[model samples]
Target: MPKVLNITAARSRLTSLVQEAFLEQKRTLIGKHGVPMAALLPIREYEELLQDLEDLGDMLQAEQEYRRTGGKDFEDVVKKPKGRR
Candidate 1:
């Protein structure tokens, strides 16, 4: 489960919070006025999340393009040889 920290508590323990986020791979949700506001996470974890999103986007785009192009198989589009070309 993720750790929840209020704004004032997060500010007061910024260093320790950062350490926990990095060394322990812990996620933190910062809240303000009793409402969730932001999160603090490790840079590596953020990078991995971005990479996963980009990969998913690429896959979806490829699928869309394939569907738009009549969805033909590769063998159906290959040119046939006529009497040894």
Candidate 2:
């Protein structure tokens, strides 16, 4: 489980919180009025999450393009007989 801290308390312990994220690879959830508002996590983890989102977006775009093109493979279309369009 991640460590949870209200904004006030987190402000007082910001240095240690940053160290925990960098060295320990731990997440800290910052909350306000009992609602989680943000997080502190390792930079590498954040980058990986961004990459995953990009990959998902690319896959969805490819699916949409395939559907728009009537699902014909590009290679199959190219290999058709010369007179057939």
Candidate 3:
């Protein structure tokens, strides 16, 4: 696991901590009472992580809906669709 910093120390060096995360491509775990509360990560990584989560949710919903509708996969349902390339 990456090294962790307490809330007080993190507050004092927020700028450097952010710089370290960016420059070293490492995460800074911040927390209180020895329990991690949050993480400092590169902006791109954070955005990608969020997008991955959204994609996972989308896949799960699609699976549930397809089961309810008794539908096959899109490829099996259609030979070709309009305005899709």
Local accuracy by lDDT, each model: 0.87, 0.91, 0.89
Clash totals, every prediction: 0, 0, 0
Weakest 10 consecutive residues, lDDT, candidate 3?
73-82
Task: Summarize candidate 1's per-residue lDDT along 1-85 as a digit string, tens digits.
Answer: 4556789899999999899889998888999766778989998999999999999999999889999986877786786777755
lDDT of 2 by residue, 1-85 (tens): 5656899999999999999889999899999876889999899899999999999999999999899988978798779798878
> What lDDT does candidate 1 reach at residue 56?
100
List runs of model 3 lying over 4 Å from the truth: 74-85
RMSD of each: 4.2, 4.8, 5.2
Candidate 2 ranges with C-alpha deviation above 4 Å = 1-3, 73-85
Report the C-alpha lDDT of model 3 over 42-67, residue by residue, as the tens digit.
Answer: 88899999999999999999999989
Give the number of the best model, judged by lDDT: 2
Name every residue pair that clashes in candidate 1: none
TM-score of 2: 0.79
